[model samples]
Target: MLPFALVASTLNSGLVSASSYKPRASVCNGHAELCDRSYGNVTFIGSHDSYAISATQVAANQDQNITTQLNDGVRMLQVQAHSYDGSIHLCHTSCLLLDGGLFSDYLTEVNTWVVANPNEVLSILIVNSDNLNASMYGAVFETSGLDKVSYAPTKATTSVADWPTLGSMIDSGLRVVTFMDNSADFTTVPYIIDEFSNVVEDAYNAVEDSFPCTANRSTGTPENQLVLTNHYLDQVGSSTSIVTPNKSKLNQTNAETGTGSVGQGASNCFQIYARSPNFILLDFYDAAGLAPFNVAAELNDVSAPTNTVANYTGGDGSTSTSTKSTASTTSTSSSLSGAGPQFKSEMMPLIVAVAVAVMAGSGLMLA
Candidate 1:
């Protein structure tokens, strides 16, 4: 059954048509120099738990939606997946805590964006907390039409140096790269690659003010894999075990140059590993405006973008027009508005009980 489904998905998977051989992109990812650079060599600013977006939700990791993040030059997006109400959903920790939406819906938005931006390459990292089968994810991708633009490598894992240039990926129309942190079976779902096999990462869920450059989670040879630096700071949330983004530290954490800054963390990794990190993941990226992007640009040797789209202010759930500002480079501790809805200490037990009940009823094991 799985084989048949995989075959069906592949046939409908809208890989770049052979007849429509487009010319190589002159500018890839906002830079002509990056067009010729290997996709693995380029540095990209990433949003941590990109789908957990809200201006008022306590569990929200981002203030803007996925489309806004992409438009503002966030090339990589990280999402946490879990089973909820008999379907896959983008959730944080657990659905009872924070539910972004259905996985298919999320992919549809991404598909729409990828189709509209032909010259840009995007990457998505899924943290499969529920340990769902790769084909289950492949099914969602197929239904959402995201499979149309998704990239499938010839092998399960490719060395960093062997990756194609960004221009080639864009020209081929296979611009979206998908990675799964766990339970990724490439033989069944070729487009969803295993992340640890191709990428290495620094520590995550960090609470320390000082970010370390040492490898914390990696199965692949560090030298042969792309580097991903987890640069976000965390703090104890409603409970001692529950950790949330340290919102108060956003200005320093996402700054271009400072102690505990993204720049400093990336630089530390580069000095120890002898290469720039391919991805630097952050929370509330809009808090410090384009600071993360500036650090990435410096690492990539490209000029930083002059302006950025303001953080989402849509309180009604409808997509709102973002105002552009040239003053994004300056540290913006003041722009970190709305402390968000606070989680009551008394609600933690109830939330945990409900989450456990839901998981038990669905026969899904939590990670």
Candidate 2:
């Protein structure tokens, strides 16, 4: 394998950051049914964001976790539009895809939980990961042994649980923001970075203008290859390019030469379709002004953030975090404890080293 550094190349050295889920209240049994009438404000998170818990955290919190936790929360949900006459679209796993490989996952979770000892979480999974090909819009997304999960789109508008839960959240005071379909390519997936970035930019601007709240997204533009992601990671320079399709890319833009890899002007477009579905499940909604190049540096900056922090592991994996739970919540009750203080602790020594590097290499805006 290529060196880790070379394999996962940093698209850029900058970052844009925002978003910290704030749970207004504790969830309860069968609460989704009472979503609209009594739940109050709702937040829906995709299953992918919910589960991806570190094996360690999952082992710790599995004992007393919610029966289900929404991953899309008031943020946004992604919708992918694929047209494969009879063939299947193979892509990375998505948080909201609820298909195949489900029952086993459910069974594993139950089995793991049963064996947990006090202080030992079977997994740090977000309860919402329970969604599979069964409910939660899951569908059969398979071609060969390489199978994937897909939340059913036909009945997406008729969710029996999410809507009410959203209502409940709204009643309780949560502002349901925007819906983000994991995928939104007007025509075809773009092969060029510019084409992909344009689609994402369009989607981002739409969601930002509509909801105005920070969001996690994986909405791609007719992208057969995963381009725009809604979530963030925490690898060394992870957030810099994991998602946030490069509307403000550091590379040269590709001309819509000949038959573009995507749509006529996808290479330059940066938004979603006007007729897409709303994943918000509720109503209401959220942007990056400078596309902060120093996002990560901003968050951990000794000074307050001037731009979005490094969107990396702010929540999406790539960093030490809890599964079934958001790592970078905006505001939660006092009961919620901060995660991985060690990550924060490690920052100082690194900063000291970087300080010396700066003196030797040059000076720059860490933020």
Candidate 3:
């Protein structure tokens, strides 16, 4: 039988080997500087109009399900909710246009994911089209079991300096943060953060030529609070139909690549605001080879997984697959390679220390 010290050293060595074999976790996992950096300073990939997804084109913002988006590393979900049939539901503009279903159902899925993956942090930005009070949203969260894990900021509005670190929030078990565009009554439900006071987002329906770095809704410089970059492109369609011409072009150029792309829009905003955008909202998140997620990882200086896009099964029982287009008109090839700033330099030393500890422990057991 193995001696006591030998058994413990073997178990420690086995644990280190197993963890090292796992894929690198989220960039925000380690490093106090990155984790404690103001929430406004961190960058997240956001899905614009996230609930408007269907097999058929129905004023869609995203082409896939919420679970798929989360799996692909979307940290922020932006949806419009309205009071429908006594309860709040996720809809686009109006229920007559597109209804994604009950808000509680959506929150349930999110809650399940949150509990399963304790390391991940997520945010929900709701456009309260119905002007429902904060309690209305709070009830849904409570019912869905999401409230238990929600983060309640001490202040009604969080300044750039007041934001907590991602690590701290995770450690405290308050990982899901929420914001509302309107009717966010902090007194009633503290977790329902006021969007306008904390985040400045560009116009949602801006044309490619008109997309600017100027703040439209929120006031003050980007340094004062968090900022969102709206990178979706829309064209004029009939009242009945919102024609998104050049969708392929929009998806191709909207990543964090070169200028003229919507991803470049972030760099443009950075130049004007003097701080990088915290959330980059994109339509057709899986388009152009999942460019939004790739761009987000790059902006945050993390290693992105292989550039793989989801094969979207349409709402109409049809199937459409997305592949990185080799034919890109934008400044650079739309197929972005893993060429971004790396995580904090201290990560290497940390990994080495773990390996050394395992080896030294094993040697001590032999002695």
Candidate 4:
């Protein structure tokens, strides 16, 4: 059976019935010089655990859906693909732990966005958790019609300086660039570029104080490879299963402060590489205002508006959760509103979960 078969019947029906929403404007607009820079020179805000957005404690890493993420100016999408029952699904660690629906569904949404936004360049990083060959995953891209616009390097390895400009890529109709963390068989799927060859990233689980600017995993030095900075902090817990952090606190403090902030993260990395990072991965990028994009603009020496969009609010306009808005190519006010959770951010999720449990227990006691 196909992966979509595993989707809950009600949810599958909703997805099928919902009208296809068109994507927002391209984030790359008005930055023509960005295209002139090396691929490694560009900075992208990546979605960590891109598929984990269901809101369940074990599974939810994001507050909104994948298309919402894309529409919010996230240029790089990082996901884990696992093969289950002969079909691929986007999951975190294991499909049983966090099944994110069909891999085809994801590529289809991306394909729709890519087709609508012709000028933008998108990057995808896949963690081959199941160790499936490139062709296996490539087949999905092919079927989704993404392969038609996918970019293949002319050689085994291409340096930042040699990488085609964003405009050049768009003109050539090669808009999508793919990277695989493992099991990349370029012979079978040439577009599935091996990630380590072109990029180096810091450890994903790094805390704020010891966050090393140095490469945790890379084939070469930061000077030679594109720097991917992993800036999200995991809430300290006794176990990984209980480590989910509060999304709002993540938006305010981590996304706004010290080493976690896009400017500071870039600054910390510049100390080591003599240049800023190429990719900045965040958990809730929508809450960071214009910090990420503005930082990228500064690094690229291009003009960026000082203003940022208003911070997103939760579904009920309450602090129970948070969500982001559609992408905006233009700028708004530059002030960092510092708007976020009224309660402490980090422990909010656990608190909410615990509060519900306590209320349930109190009712049981009365009964």
Best by TM-score: 1
User: Model 3 scores what on Cα lDDT?
Assistant: 0.63
Q: Please give the CA lDDT of all the candidate structures.
A: 0.74, 0.22, 0.63, 0.62
lDDT tens digits, residue span 1-367, model 4 = 1111222231222212212322232334346555444455566778787766633343355655566666656788888889886798886555555566678878877888789888788999998887888888888998889999999988757665566656567767787999998888778888889998888888775434345567889775556777898876555443322444445355443343453555566677776766566688876555556655655655656676444343443222213222333343221111111232234433444455445446655311000
TM-score of each: 0.81, 0.23, 0.74, 0.75
Clashes of each: 0, 90, 4, 3
The order of the candidates by TM-score, greatest first, is 1, 4, 3, 2
Clashing pairs in 4: 306-334, 307-333, 307-334
Which ranking of candidates, highest lDDT first?
1, 3, 4, 2
Among all windows of 10 consecutive residues in model 1, the one with the lowest summed lDDT is 1-10
Residue-level lDDT tens digits of model 3 in 78-156 = 9889999888998655565456789998888778778877766789999898799999899999999999999999888
lDDT of 3 at 321: 39
After superposing candidate 2, which stretches have Cα over 4 Å from the reference?
1-40, 44-103, 107-162, 165-367
Looking at model 4, residue 270 earns an lDDT score of 72
State how far residue 353 of model 3 sits from its true place (Å). Answer: 61
Estimate, for each residue in 1-367, the C-alpha lDDT of model 1 and write its tens digit: 0011122221122221222333378989988877767777788999898887656555667876676677788899999999999999988777876677899988887787788888999999999998999999999999989998999998998888777778788888998999999999978999999999999998888889688778877898987788898888887644334455677777778777779988788768766666678899987777776777877777776787776656544232223233463322211221223344445622553467456655665322111
lDDT of 2: 0.22
Q: Specify the highest-lDDT model's number.
A: 1
